[model samples]
Each structure stands twice: as C-alpha cells, then as structure tokens.
Target: MGKGKNKTHEPKNERQQRGANGHSARQNHKHMEMKYDKSEKMKFPVKLAMWDFDHCDPKRCSGKKLERLGLIKSLRVGQKFQGVVVSPNGQGVVCPNDLEIVEQHGASVVECSWARLEEVPFNKIGGKYERLLPYLVAANQVNYGRPWRLNCVEALAACFAIVGKMDWASELLSHFSWGLGFLDLNKELLEIYQRCTDADSVKKAEKEWLEKLEMETQERKSHTKKTDIWMMGNINRRGNGVQSDELESGEDSEQSGLENSEQPIEYDALGNAIHVDSVKSRIMLSGVSEDEESDFEENEKPVNYDSLGNLI
Candidate 1:
C-alpha cells in the first residue's frame, strides 16, 4: 500500500512541474512580444497634421500613407487648430521668423488637388497663422521635377527645413523612397531661403533666384540661336562648294557693287510702286501715277498669308 501511494504522488508532482514549465515559457514569449512592440513604435519629433480632401488616390496619396504609418494626424474639414496652416492662399511665406510659432503650435497642411484648389473652403479652415511655402521642387513621382507642386509630406518637410528643423524634415521625408531626394534637388534654393530671417527676406531671395534663372534661360536661348545661325551659314557655304574666305570676299564684292547695280521695283508708303534706275540716278513711278494714286481707294478686304509667307 505505501509503495502504490508514493507512486501516485510522484506522477502528480511530475504533471504539476510540467504545467509550471509550460506556463513560464508562454509568459516569457508574451513579455518578449510586448518589448518588441515598444521598440517598434514610431515617435514623430513634431505634431504634424493635415486636412485631407480625399481628392487623390488612396494608394498614391502621401497624406494617407503618412496617416497609416502614424506619422501624421488627419483633421476634418473646417476643423480648428492653433498650428501654422500651410495653404495655397496663405498670408505670407514660411520663413525662419515663424520657427517659434511652428515649434509651439506645430504645423498642418491642406491636402487637395492643385486642380481643385478653388473648391477648397479656405475661409472655414482654422489656424492661428496661415503661410505659403517658398519655391521648392517636387520629388514625388507624379509631379517630379515640377516646382510648387509638392504633396502634403513635401510641403510639411519644406516648412520644417525653413524653420531650422532639418532633422525633422529629413525624418518626415525618410518614409518615402523619393522623399529625401527633394532636399537634394532644391539644395541651393532651400539653403538660400533657409538663411532668410523673415518673409521679406525670403521674398527677396526668391526674386533673386527667379531673376538668375531667367537670365540663364535667356543666355541659353541666345547661345542656341548663335549655334543655329553658324550651322546654317556653314551648310550654305558647303552646298555652294565655296570656302569661308572665298565666300566672305564674294559677299564683300557683291555688297560694294550693289550701290551701282539697278535696284528692284519697290512700294512706297501709299502703296504706289517706285522703280530705282542706277544709271539714270532717279526714281520713276510704275504701278500707280501720283494723280491716279490720289484717286485710289483703300481695300477693306482682309488679307491672309500662307505658311510660306505668300499672300493667300
């Protein structure tokens, strides 16, 4: 009897130990999972928000993507916020002077299509300060290489960069593959805008940059024109089987002899024809005589020209 009793107790103890080991393992796994969750949680540096108008494709919309990643918060239409509002009709441009307001109140952007900008109820949008972003190139695939066509994240990033929150800007843009490239594409322009102290300075900087761009474009066009002219001249000379020196000499002789040659018949201001006779050293009327010209009436018909500049 004692041996049998001891055997029964041994089995019970073994079962109990096994149950305890299994529970401990399960608890250890649960703890590990919780620890991982904490580590993986993303912490945004600033309180970034936006008002999405659902005007873009869900898959392609940067604002929605950021919201899914918990990087940005979305507000309803006409919702009130004390942050700096990025609007197309902003009162002024975002600059370093607004850094304090941005840091204190955070920043928010209006997410809508550039086409439907007029449909947006700007008056209902609430914000302590409404500001426009300075000129910045888009890095998103859709509007890549286009200026002032930034998506929500890009606009926010630009504001952050202008306010001296470069790390924040970088972090905001880091989510997208082409995001960081935006800063690189507009590196010089951004740097110039970032250095400005206020809206006035930013405006001045933008003006200067625009002027420089315009000048460069004009220079490029002039260079292209000169190149085209030279190529045409060269082709003409080659086609005529003439050397450059010979062509120049021929042109000079032709110009000098032109004064002595009989000139072609031409029209005067009154539509009367005048014939030039170099030998007689006098002008003669041909198409209409002076008395007949006075009696002529002006034609009221519309004149048309063909593509080749011939009267049609």
Candidate 2:
C-alpha cells in the first residue's frame, strides 16, 4: 500500500514540475522575442493631428509610437489646427497616430501630441494664431485673474522683436497692468527703449500699437455703454427713484421761482432801489419788454403794513 501511494505522489510531483518548466520556457521565449524585435519599426499613423495645448493628459502619450513617426519633439504653445476638408478626419500635415482626439468643436478638434508643427507666419493664419499667444501664456502661467498682465507685456516684447522697435514695446508695456507680473518685463522693455537708436521709428510703432489697443478698448467700452444705456432706459421706463427725483427737483425749482416772482413786492427802504432796478434790468435783459415790465408793476400788490405803520 505504501509503494502504491508513493507512485501516485511521484507522478503528481513530476506533472507539477513539468508545468512550471513550461511556464518558464514560455517567459524566456517571450524575452528572446522582445530582444530580437528591438530593431522592429514602431507603429504610427502618417497624417495630420490636432492637439489642445490648454488641457492634455501627458500620461497618455505613447513615447515609442511618437518616436516611430517622423514627428518633431516639441510643438508651439497655442497652435491651432484643422482637419483637411478633403482628407478623412485625422489625415493631413499632422500625423494622427501621435495624438488622440480629446475634444471636438465645430469643424476643429483637440488632440494631444508632443510633435512640433512647421513654423508659419502670424499673418499667414490671418492673425488668429497671433491673438491666441497672450491667452496661452497666461494659461500656462496658471494665473487667470491677471491674464492680461504678463501677456500684454509679452505681446509688446514680441511685437518689438519682430518689428525691431524697442521704444514701441516700452510704450505698449506702459499701458499694460503694471502690478500684474509686469515689473521685470517693464524694466527690460525700458532698457530696450533706452537703447533705441531710431526713436522716430519706435514712436511710430508705439503709436500703431497704442491705436490698436485703443480701438479694441473703445469697441469694448462702446458695447458696455450700450448695455448700460439699455439698462438705464429700462429702469427709467419703470420710474426709478433717482431719475424721478431728478425730474421732480428740476420742475419744483422752476415752479418755485415762478411763484416767487408772481408774489407782490414791497420796498422797506429807499436803499433797496438799486436792487429792485437790477432785478428789473435782469427781467428786461431776459426779453421782457418795457410794456410787459409796466404790466408787471401794475399787477403787483403791496405787502401787509407793519406795526410801525411803515409799508412792509
């Protein structure tokens, strides 16, 4: 009976050892295959891709896949892209494999990639991309409350760099919110401004930027003013107290003056003759004719006499 039990246990042990060896062999085979496949080309699509610089999860990036594609290592912040109208969804200048679509808006979509796009002139994109740089920088800084601060200064610096006009940048920086992370930039711009050899040229560029900023500000103000006027009109139509009081006060003052003038006048002293004459002259100057003045005098009545018997 003992011999029979040993035989059974021996077979079971041998089977378990065989299973373990098979598993080890498979793992070794897989490792060998990986070593051999090291030179294999990475898999990536060849087409245009879109990316949202504003929000992208970096962990989702497939580094091996991106390296396989002939994509640049970096992309400009605030870059915009559109799918080719003719090419199907993600097929065009930007390879689609390097990015995954995260969001869609109208004709455009957002994707994620570390690949850089070809540099294009700001004017080539109709200044749309140029306008986005400020906001993008602000977003990158993670301080939206002062979005325009550094952005405005950076914009001025960029403009100056492009135009070769330092004074223009300085002047533009002056108008920006100084307290909003702009002190260092402002100082740098001032240094540039001081080094400017062509003040006139810089001045012209400064004027242009100022005019552009002013125009934008004016448009915003006009829109705000229109809204305020609409609100005020609505309130006035509903008879708001402030508007009502202003109107009421004006009417009351006019009526009071008229009533006082209509009351009788009596001189207690001869010295008041100049004052009365001056009043008469003022009325005549206001277009009351001599005949009208005489009518006014005749219509006027004496005041009540005082206890001293003198005319009050």
Q: Which candidate's lDDT is highest?
A: 1
Q: How many residue pairs of model 2 clash at the backbone?
A: 6
Per model, state how many residue pairs clash: 0, 6
Q: Against the true structure, candidate 2 has what lDDT?
A: 0.31
The TM-score values for the models, in the order shown, are 0.64, 0.19
Off by over 4 Å in 1: 1-41, 230-233, 236-312
The deviation in Å at residue 32 for candidate 2 is 42
Backbone clash pairs for candidate 2 read: 47-94, 47-95, 48-92, 48-94, 49-94, 51-111
Candidate 1 versus truth, CA RMSD in Å, comes to 20.4
Q: Write the per-residue lDDT of candidate 1 for residues 142-250, one digit (tens) a residue.
A: 9998988899999999998998888988998998999999989988988898899999999899989889989999988765644433322222311224444543444
Which candidate wins on TM-score? 1
Q: Relative to the unseen true structure, what is the C-alpha lDDT of residue 248 in candidate 2, on a scale of 0 to 100?
A: 41
Cα lDDT listed for each candidate? 0.65, 0.31
